[model samples]
Target: MELLVKSIALKSPLYTSVHLIIILASAILGFLAYKRNPNNPNNRSFLMLNLSLAVFVAVTYLSNLDLLSISTQIFINRLTFSIGFILVIVFFNFCLIFPEKETKKSFVYQLLIIACLGLAAFAAFFDWMAVEKVVSGLVTFRPRYPGIFRLFFYVYALFAFWGIGILYQKIRKLKGKERTRVQYVFLATLLYIIYIFSTNLIPAYFGRRFFIGHTALGAIVFVGLISYAVIKHRLMDIKLVLLRSLAYLTMLGSLAGAFIFFVYYLKVYYQQFVDPDIVFVLASFIAAFGFQPLRRLAEKTTDNLFFRSNYDFNEALSKLSAVLNHGVVVSKLTDDLLGELKAILKAQNGLFILSKDENKFLYCLAKNSKSVTIEELEREEDIIKLREAGLEVVVNIPDDDKCYGVLALGPKQSGESYSTRDLRLLEIIAPQITMAIKTAKSQEELIEKVIEERQRINQDAHDRIYNRLGAMAKLSEAAAAQSKDKELFEQLDSGLRQTVVDLQKIVNKDTATIKTNGKLASSLKKICQQHQKDYNQAVKYSFKASNMLNLDDMAWDIECILQECLNNAGKHSGAKKIRVNLAQNNGNLVLEVADNGKGIHNLDISNLPQEHLGINGIIDRVAKFQGIVDINSNNDGTKILVSIPLG
Candidate 1:
C-alpha cells in the first residue's frame, strides 16, 4: 500500500510539474518578447509563437489536475485543446513573419491553415476527435469516436514542416546577428519536431503505450535558446529575468527534495500508528501552502551566501547612475567615477583619462597614483602591455563620432586577478559610463558655445551700435556749433531719430510673437506673409502637417533665423521673389530660403564680420541651438539652409 501510494503521488505530479514548468517558462518568454520591444514585428511574431506553445503545455498540465469536477475538466480540456489546435496555424503565421521578414506564403498554404483551424473547431464542438465520459466524477480520455485524429496530426505536421522549411530558407539568406537569431529558432523547431515524432507518433504507430508522450519537457531547451538569442545577441535585458528564474527553480527543487524525504520518513515512522492515507494528505497540505514562504526564505539565504558581492556591485552602480542622471558637472563626473571604481574594484588606485582628439590623454583624473604617464598610454600597444601586466584597462568613446576615454584600475589589495564576477560587473556598467561621459561633454560644449556666442554678440554691439553712437556724439557737437543754422539743426534731429529706430530694430529682431501652442508653421507663414504684404516682396513658403514643432525657444530661434534671412533678402539682396521651404527631415527641422536677385559674392558665413549683423545674427542664433547653417551665393541668388534638431 505504501509503495503504491508513493508511486502514484510522485509519478503523476512529476509529469504535471514538468508541463507546468514549461508553461510558466514559455509564458515568461512571451511576456518578455513583447516587453522588450512592443513595436518590433519580430517580437510580435515571437510572442504569438510562445503563446501557442504555452497553451499547448497548459492543456497538457490540466489533464493531470485531479481535484476539478468531471464536467469542468471536460470543458477545460475541450477549450484548451481547441486553443492549442488553432495556435498551430498561429505558429505557422509567426514563421512567415519571424525575424522581421515579411514573406507572403502561397495561396495553398493559407487555405491549408484555414482548413486546419476549421477542422479543429469541428473536433472541439463534436465528440469526434476526443470523446470521454465521467467516471467516478473524474473525466478521462477514452477511445476516439471514429474521428480523424491521425488526419489532424498529419495536417499539423504538414503546416509545421512548411513553416520550418520557410524559416530555413530565410536563414540561408541572412547574415550576422540576423542569421544567428533565425538559426536559434530553426534549431529549436527542428529539435522539438524530432522529439514529437520519436516520442509520440512513432511509438503510437507501432501500437505501444509509450511514456514518451510527455516529451514536451524538451520545451525548456526551446525557450532557453530563444531567450539566450534575445539577451546575448539582441541586447534585451535578461538580468532580472535570469536571476528570478534561477532563484525560483533553486527554491522549488530544494523544497521538493526535502518533501520527498519527509514523506519517506513519515511513512516509516507514522504508518504503523496513523493511516498512510493520512500521511499522504499531510504531505500534500505541506507542499501546497509551504512552498511560497519556503521559496522566499531560500532566496534570501542564497542571496546572502552566494550573491552578496554581486548585490553590493549592483547597488553601487545604481547610486552612481542616479548621480549621472542628475545635473552633475563633467569635472565632478570624472572624480565621482574614479572614486566608485576604486571602491568597486577594491583597487589601491584608479585613473580616468579622456582624449578629445583620440590621439592623446589630455584630461586625467588619477586617484592615489603617479606612476602612469599620458605619453606611454597614448599607444595601443602600451595599453595592451599594461593590461597584460595584471592591470584592468577599458577604453571606450562616449559616441561614435567624438572623443574616447580610458579607465585603468591598478592591482587589487589581495594581489589576485579580477574574478569573472568582477569583470561582469564592470562590463555591465561600461555603457552607462560612456553615456555619462557623453552627457558631460554635451554640457561642456553648450557652455562653451554660449560663451563664444556672447563674445560675438558683444563684438557686434561694439562695432555696429556703439560705434554709431560715438559718431552721433560728434554730429551733436557739430549741430551745437551750428545752432544758429536752423536747417542743419533740423537735419541732425531727423538723422538722430532714424538712427534710434535702426538701433531698436537690431535689438528687437527676435519679436515676442512666438506661439505657446506649438504652431510653428503658422508663425513661420505669418512672418512670410507679413514680409510680402508689408514690403510688397513675393515670398512663397511650403510646410507639411507632420512638420509640427514644439520646442521651447528652439522654434523661436528658427523663426528669428528665417526672419533674418528674409530681411536680408528684402533689404540687401535687391531680390523681388523669395521661396521659403520648411520640413521635418530625420528628426531635424530644415529651412531653406532662396531669393531671385543680384547675389552677394564671398558669402562664406564664417568670414562675415561682427558689423554684418544680418548674417552674424543668423549664425549666432543657430549656434545657440546647436544648429547648422549653409550659405550659397552666386550671380543667380542667395540660398540659406538651416537645420536644427527637433529635440
Candidate 2:
C-alpha cells in the first residue's frame, strides 16, 4: 500500500487529477453551450475540443494509474497527443467558419488543414517524433528526432499565433461588448499557447518534470477565466450551455460522492466492493433523466434573469403601421415610435432615422437615457448600415424591395446584445412599417394636390369675372359720352364715370398682374414714358434685377402684388409724382411703389366697407406664398414694400 501510494505521488497523480478536473469543467461548459446553441459553429468547435481534451485527460490518468502495460501506455500517450493535435486543427477550422480574415481565401484554409494533418501524421507514426515512457515514475514524451517534432511545434505555434492575431485584429475593429468578448477569446488562446509552449520547452531544456503539474494548473485557470467570461458577458450567447453544464455537474458530483460513501460504508457488512462502474452508470442515467426538466427550469430561470418578457418587437412595429395608416404627421409618427421602442427594447437610448433616399437620412426621432447629442448618434456607421440593410421590419415594403430606413432602438440596458430571435422579430415587422410609411406619404401628396387645384380654380374665377366687368364699364363710358341733352348727359356721364371707377377698383382687386415687357427695366421705362404723356405728374420708374430673374409662380405672384399696389397708388392716391422701382437684393425680389399724395392720416382703413377689398386681398395673396407685405404712410407720400421668396 505504501509503495502504491508512493508510486501515485511520484507519478504526480495530483497533476492528472487537476487535468481531469479542468477537462471535465471545459467539457460541461462546451456541452451546455452546444445544447443551447447547436448551430453556433464556435460553440460546436469548442465542444469538440473539450470532448477531445476529456478523452486525452482520461487516457493520461489511466496511464498514470499503471493499470496497463508499458506498450499500451505508450500507445495511449501517442493517441492523446494525436487527439490534442487534431483538436487544435479543428479549432482553426472553427475559426474559419466566421473568419476575421477574408474567408474567400480558400487556399489559405486548405493549406492550414494540410499542415495540421501532416503534423498529426508525424506525431502518430514517427517514433522519433514522440516517444513516451515512464521517467522518474512520471509518464513523459521525449523527442528522439527533434528536428521533425520541432518543425511541427513551430508550425503549430505559428497557427496558434495566427489565430490570436486574427482575433486581436477583429477585437480592435469591434466596439463595446463584441470587442470585450473577442479580447477574452484572444487572451484565453494566448494563455493556452503559452502553457503548451512553455511546458514543452521546460522539459526539453532541463530534462526534468518541472511543468507537469504547472501545465494543468495553467489550464485550470485559463478555462475558469473563459467560462466566467462566457457567463458574465454572454460572449457568443454561450451562457445557456455553461449554466446547464454546471447544474448537471453539481448534481452528478453530489450523487457520485453519495454512492462512493454508500459503497465504503457497505463494504464491511457485504465483504464485497461495490463496482464504481455501477455508480457511474446510475449517475449518468439520473443526469440523462433530469436533463429535460432541468433544461426547462434553466430556460425559465434564463427568461427571468436575461429576457424578462417576450419582447414583441413585431407588436411595436404593428402600432407604428397603424399610426402611419391613419395618415399621422411625420413628427407625431417619430415620437410614437421612439416612445414604444424605449419600452419594448428596454433601451438606454433610442434613435429612428427615416431614409429620404439612399444617401440622405432624416433625423426624425430620438429618445435618450442620458443627455445625448443627436449628432453623435446620427454619425454612427452601425446606424447607417442598419438603414442600408433595410431591416426595419420582417415583411418587405411592397412598392420597393429595399428598406426605406431603419428603426434602430437601443444599446439595451446593461449593453446586452440583440439575440438571433430579436433580429428575426425585427425582420418580421419591417414590412408593415414600410406599408405604413407608403400610406402616409401617399396621403400627404394627395393633400398637397388638392390644395394646389383649389388655388388654381380661385385664380381662374377671379380673372374671368372681373375682366368681363371691366369691358362692360368701358362700354357704359362710351355710351355716356354720346348723349345729346345737357342735364341727361351730365347725369349719365357722372354715373358712367362712377361705374368706370368702381369697375377699375374691381379689376385692380382681382387682377394684380402688371404687364411688363420681358426686359423689366425696359418695361418700366415704357410705363414712365406713357405716364408722362397722359398725367400732369412727372412719372419716373426704375427697375433692376441683380441677375436675370427667371420668374416662377411665386415670382409672378410677387409681381402681381406689386402691380396692385402701384395701381392703387395711381387710381386712389392721386399723387403729383409717382415712382416705381424693382430690384433683386439678398436672393429676394424687392419691389417698391411710392407716391407723393395727401397723407390721409385719419384714414380708418380697418373700418372700410366690405366693397373695399384691396388691402385684405393683397395681404391674403402675399400670405399664400409666404411673402411679406409692408404698407407705410407719411405726410408727403405712401410707400408699399412687397418681398417674395424665390422658389
Candidate 3:
C-alpha cells in the first residue's frame, strides 16, 4: 500500500516512454478507424480494443506517479482489469467482423458478449482482494493469484486463440490483396498475444517476483503492424492512417517546436539567474496553452497542402458533366463515367455496382478492384472482400425516392483523405448517373413491351383476315356450284387465289421481319409451306444452293418469282401435278417448272410477259434479274425454264 505513495523519480524511463508511445499510436489507429465509418461494427470493435489499451496504459502510468490514494489505486486497478476483459471481447469481436460486419445479434455472438460483461463485472472486485503488495514497483501479479485473476487470463487466452483462428480462416478464404491484409492483421495479433504471454503471463508462471507491468505498452507491436496494413494494404483503408496521422503529426511537431523555442528564449534571458525547474514549467505552459489552436491550424494547413491545393471543384463538375452528356449509350456512359471519376479522384482502385434486384444487377465495373465480389460492398468474414482492398467511400446514387445503387470509391492514389468537398462532388454527380441507369432500364422494358404488343397484333390480324377470306372462298364455291359454268368457276377461283396470295405477302412481310437464320433457303421453305396451306395442292420443289448468294434483296425477288410461277401453274395447268427445280451452278441460278396440264396455245417464251397476268408477272420478274426464259407446251404437260446470272 505504501508503494502507492512511493517517490515519482523511481518510475523507469523505459516504462514511461513505452506507455506514452502506445497511447499515442493506439489513439491514432482507434480514432481513424472510428472516423472513417462510424456505423461499421468492425471498426467500432477495433476502436474499442484500442481505447481500452490506451486507458489501461494511462491509468497504470498515473498509478506509478503516486497521484492516487491506496483505495483509489485499488479501484482504478480493478476498473482497468475490467477494461482488459472488455478489450479481449472487443478483439474477438473485431476478428469476427474483419473485411466486413458480421451478424452480432446471433446467439453465439450475444452469448460471448454477455459472458465478457459478466467477467468484467466480477473483475473489478475479485482482482484486488489480495493483501496489498507490489512486484516491479507495480501490482502486476500476486504470489498466489485469486480465481478471478486466472479466470480473466483463461478468457483472454481463449478469445485470443479463437480470434486468431477466425483470422486464419479469412486469410485462407480470401485472395490477392485481401488475403495479404488478413495475413498482416493475423500476424500482428499473433505477435501481440505472444508478446503478452512473454511480458505479463510467462514471468508469473515461473514464480518470478519482480514483474514487468508493461503488457499495455507492448501493444505497440499490434498498433504498428495494423498501421502498416492500413497504409500499404488498406485494411480499413489507407486514408485511415494517412489523413489524421499526417495532420496531427504536424500539430505535434508544431507543439514540439514551440516548446524548444520557449526553452531557448527563457535560457537566454535568465542565464545567470536561471532555475531549470521554473524554465521547464514556463515552456510547457506556453506549449500546452497553444496546443488546441495550433492543432486546428496545423490540421487545416496539412489538408490544404496534401489534397485541397490541386482540387478544383469547377473543373471536377465540368468533367463530370462532360461524361454525363456523352450520350445515353448505357454501356459506354457507365464505363466512361467510372473512368472519369477514378481519374478525377485519383483513386488507387474502385468499384461501381448498380443492382436492380437480388438476382439482376444493372452494371458492374472495376478500376482494378483485384476481383472484389458483389456481396463485398460491405465486406465481411463471408459478406464481402473489397473493404480490405482500399475501399474508402460509398456514396448512394439516389433519385427521387429510390436509390439506384452505390458508387464505392477506393483510397486515393496520393493516399489523401476523401474530404467532404470530394463527397459533395459525388453527391452532385449521383443523380445524373441515376438518370442514365434509369434510361437503360427503361429501354429494356420498352423492348419487352414492343415484342408483346407485336405478337398480339399479329394474332388479331391472322384471326380476322383468315376468317373473312375463308368465308369469301366458301361463297365463291357456292356461286360456282349453282351457276354450273366451268369457265366462270375457273375465273373466280383464279382471281380469289391471286388476291389471297398478294394479301398474305403484304401482311406477313410487314408483321414479321423474320431473318430466317441468315439463309435464303429457310425463307423459301416457309414460302413453300404457306403455298400448300393456301391452295391445298402440293408443288414439289427441289433447291440446291451451290454457293452463298451475295445478294440480299435477291431473296425477296426470287420468292416473288416463285409465287407467280406457282400461281400460273396451279391456275391453268389443271392436269394434276407440278414440280419446281431450282439449282445454282457456276454463278448462275436455273429454275425449271413443269406440270401435267392442258398446254397454252402459241405461247411466246421471249415475250410471255405480254401474255396472261400471272405468266406476265413471272416473265417481268425473270427479265429484271437479267435472266432468260424458255417455254415448251405439249398435250400432256408444259415446261418453263428460267436462268439468272449471279455476278
As for TM-score, the candidate ahead, 1 or 3, is 3
* Model 3 local distance difference test score: 0.66
lDDT of 2 at 401: 41
The TM-score values for the models, in the order shown, are: 0.41, 0.43, 0.44
Candidate 1 ranges beyond 4 A from true positions: 1-13, 64-84, 105-109, 129-147, 205-215, 235-647
Clashing residue pairs, backbone N/CA/C < 3 A, model 2: 32-241, 33-241, 393-427, 393-429, 393-430, 394-427, 394-428, 394-429, 394-430, 395-431
lDDT of 3 by residue, 1-647 (tens): 46543534466767777888889878877777776566678778778878877886786566445444556656665666677677778788788887756654589778878988998888677644443465443453353464545666778788888999989988888997778888998998899888877776555555553233556666778878877777556676544335556767888987898798878887888867989789999888888888888876765665565454465778989988888775465667777888888888887766566764521222232222322222224333322344454565666666575656767777677655575346657878888888877786677678777885564344333333443355347547766677875654664565567557546655555423434344666666665655554455677878788654445646555666666555555556675677888788777888787888887887776665533545555565677788877788888888888888987
Misplaced by over 4 Å in model 2 are 1-76, 82-232, 236-306, 310-327, 356-400, 446-562, 568-575, 579-647
| TM-score of candidate 2 to 2 decimals | 0.43
Q: How are the candidates ranked when ordered by TM-score, highest leading?
A: 3, 2, 1
Number of the top-ranking candidate, with lDDT as the measure: 3
Encode model 2's per-residue lDDT on 585-639: one tens digit a residue: 7877777778898654654544656554565556667778677877778788888
Clashing pairs in 3: 99-379, 100-379, 100-380, 376-384
lDDT of candidate 3 at residue 3, scale 0 to 100? 51
- Residue 326's lDDT within candidate 2 is 64
lDDT string for model 1 (546-606, tens) is 7456765666557667767776786677898999998888888789999998898876677
Model 1, residue 413: displacement in angstroms? 28
- lDDT of each structure? 0.64, 0.56, 0.66
Clashes of each: 0, 10, 4
